[model samples]
Target: MFEPRLALASLSGEADAEWARAGADWAGAAVLGGVCLDRSTREAARAMVADRDRSEFLPDDPITFVDDQLAALSGVDLRPGINVRSTTAEPVREVAAVAADHDAFVEINAHCRQDELCAAGAGESLLREPERLEALVAAAATGADVSVKVRTELDGVDLVAVARRVEAAGADAMHVDAMDSEARVADVADATDLFLIANNGVRGRESVREYLEYGADAVSVGRPSDDPAVLDRVGDAVAEWFAEEQSPREVEP
Candidate 1:
């Protein structure tokens, strides 16, 4: 878990150590990648770029890239993390080992909704396959602290149930991208004690307050993570909220 309760969420190709370092003054934690950990997912990432002009972190050796990224953040104060996409547990296990070595956490990417990633049995497709997702979470937990980035409002998929399974699988956090259904944060918070990080459309105090009130342990800034003005606004709001939360309330006579 991170302090100040503010996080900089992963932005596929742009979220590298340099990106995280640039935002470090505002956020308490920085999650890097959506990095493809194996061949199938890497090919899918390539297809996404080639077919749709999407950017991806296509390192020649993902594990080594992970090592270097985390190592780059060793002198930084914020908690560093990696968001990974893989079809099997072995690669997850490998990357998690590197995360452990760097005192960083590993986040399983169950939130990416791209068609190519889903077709490769990674990303949002994992939400439809609970057992496999749980196994990947468990595999990651063996080496390092595990966080599962999940998407909400998917038809017929119970995100609350998924949160429970992730906790049972030894995950330490649940990063929820509550697309349009922000109330789902309360639902998942009600069901599990996993450290909940709420995401999507977070710009200022009102958006930050909504999620904190809904029981999110932290709030993350996605697309605007690099904007200092937005980060200053969100980061200050988070500090104010947590300060207010800890203040003693007086009873009325």
Candidate 2:
């Protein structure tokens, strides 16, 4: 579990060790990449970069990239995690071993909605195939702590039920991109004991407080993660809220 309870969510090509380290003072953990883990997904990720002109981490050797990135963060105090995309469970196990070696966590990418990734059976497409997603989670857990990054409000998909499945697969955390529905955080928290990290529209104390009030154990800042102003505000809010929760209350007799 993340102390300070604030995480920096992965942002495609931009989230690297340097980026995560920049926000280290505020965040307890940083989930890096949306790294393409296998041949099919890596090929798909390349197409995405070409077609969409988006920045993505497309390294020649992805597992080595993961190892290198985590190694770079060795001096940083925050917990390191890798967010990976793959069509099979084998690659997850491979990266999970590297993650375990670094004392890091493995986050399965079930939240991305990229068309190319979806076409390749990666990303949010996993939500529709609960069995595969569970298998991936179990594979990652075999080597290290596992977290499944999922999006909320997808049609015909029940997040609470998915949370249960993820937990059953030995996932230690659930990263929920609550989208437009923050209440889903409470719903998932009610249904499972997995540590919930609420994401989306998290800018300041108001947004952070809302998620915590809805039962989120932590909150992650996505796009603006590198902004010190945002990091400062969110970090302060988290510290203050947790402090109040731990402080002794006065009793009027």
Candidate 3:
């Protein structure tokens, strides 16, 4: 069995630095900065360029954040955000440019619940329009590694179909916001063979185990480090799990 990988869901470049200081092992792991599509948010993020403030703040611009994250976490791989709307093509190009420039992976954002994002034809709302979603993935995949982030819903839209369409559109991976259910994860895993990174409400080792069993290729965690001890414990748990799995089986006497 392959050892599971862990990624820190960084809200900004500063948050990425904090995760590194918190003893996160970044080798072969990813550091994903949140979506940075808004104007004001972009301005603030730009001001914080090279500024290492660990204080809480909003998400940073995907481009700028990815650049800094690549430098800060040199050994780790970078996956930047790319929250695009259903109709627009401008943001698609911008996100693709950033991904190419930084030599980083681009993740299409469809999991954010912000009202402005939804009203602007972005975020989870994009999941409702399969054709548009396919187009966005197609356009994004043209430049770099493109992954789509989607939330699992009970009714509204058909997520399985969406996953298949995204995979067919040449997306390198699928970031499934499972919210809190292994069944939803299994649904996504069953729908496509694309690399799946399970997110949302993943708090500890047990939750990670459940996601892995459901066929997740990786897991992302956020805010669990609010308690330093919890961060250490989680890291140890992950390392222990990998160590034990890597150990060879004992031979019979």
Q: Please list the residue runs of candidate 3 whose C-alpha ends up more than 4 Å from where it truly belongs after superposition.
A: 1-4, 10-23, 26-31, 38-72, 75-87, 225-228, 239-253
Could you give me the TM-score of model 2 versus the true structure? 0.99
C-alpha RMSD in Å of predicted model 2 compared with the true structure: 0.7
**lDDT for each residue of candidate 2 in 51-91, tens digit (9 for 90 to 100):** 98999999999999999999999989899999999999898
lDDT of 1 by residue, 205-252 (tens): 999999999999999999999999999999999999999989999889
- TM-score each candidate: 0.98, 0.99, 0.73
User: Poorest 10 consecutive residues of model 1 by lDDT?
Assistant: 153-162
What digit string (tens of lDDT, one per residue) describes model 3 on residues 185-245? 7888887888877777666678766777788877766666345555555555566666776
Q: Rate the local accuracy (lDDT) of all candidates.
A: 0.94, 0.94, 0.62
Clashing pairs in 1: none
Give the deviation of candidate 1 from the true structure as CA RMSD.
0.8
Give the distance in Å from residue 39's predicted Cα in candidate 3 to where it truly belongs.
7.4
* lDDT at position 210, candidate 3: 75
